[model samples]
Target: MYYIVMNMNCEDCGRYIPHSVYKYIGFCEEQGKVVFNEPPTNCDTVSKTTMDSLSSVFGSLGWVYCIDCKAPIFEMEEAVKHIASHHLITTRFMYDSVAAEEVGAVS
Candidate 1:
C-alpha cells in the first residue's frame, strides 16, 4: 500500500504548511492511483476541466519529509515508522516551512 504523509508539521524545524508534503509507496506500478490529500467530492465531474488544467502545472511538483522532527527522510516508510514510535508530533502538514521558502526560486 502507498503511504501519504499529509498535514504533518516538523517538530525540529517548526515548518508548517498545508497540503504540501507528500510521499508515495508502490508508485512503480502502471495501474496505480494517485491519492490526493482529501477525498474527491461529488462535484469532481464538474471540476474535472479545471483539475486537468491544474494538473499540467502542479503534476510535477511534490515534496517529501519526515512527519516528525521535520528531518529529511530518505527512506520514507521505515523512517516514518521509527519516528512515530519514538517521537510525538503535534501537527502535520504537506510542506516543510523551510521548503516553503524555496518556492520563490521555482519561478
Candidate 2:
C-alpha cells in the first residue's frame, strides 16, 4: 500500500490532492497497464459492478473527479467513496437502486 502525494492542484479550487495509490487500481509492469484484481468475496455486488463499469469507461487512463467541484478525485472506487464521505453526496451509479428494484420486480 503506497500513499502518493499528488503535486497537481485541484482544477476547481487549486488545492493539493493526496491519494492512496493502492486504494485504487494499479499498474503492472509485466502487464503493461493498470489492472483490477478480483474483488474479495465479502465485497458487495453493487461495488463490484461499479468497479467493472468504471474500468470499462475509463479503461487504463480514467480519472475520477469530484461530483461537486469537478476536481480530480482519486480513482473510481475511492472517488465514489470519497464523494459520499466528504461531500455527503451519493455517487450515482448507472446500476443504482432503481435499477435494482426493477430487476427485483422482474424476478
Q: Highest lDDT: which candidate?
A: 2
**C-alpha lDDT score of every prediction, in listed order:** 0.33, 0.34
Give each model's clash number.
Answer: 10, 0
Cα deviation at 53, candidate 1, in Å, is 22
lDDT (10s digit) by residue, model 2, range 1-107: 22221221121111112122222233323334433432323322212223354555456546655534545644666665653454311222122235445455553
* Model 1's TM-score against the true structure: 0.22
Once fitted onto the true fold, the runs of candidate 2 whose alpha carbons sit more than 4 angstroms away are 1-49, 86-107
TM-score of each model, in listed order: 0.22, 0.26
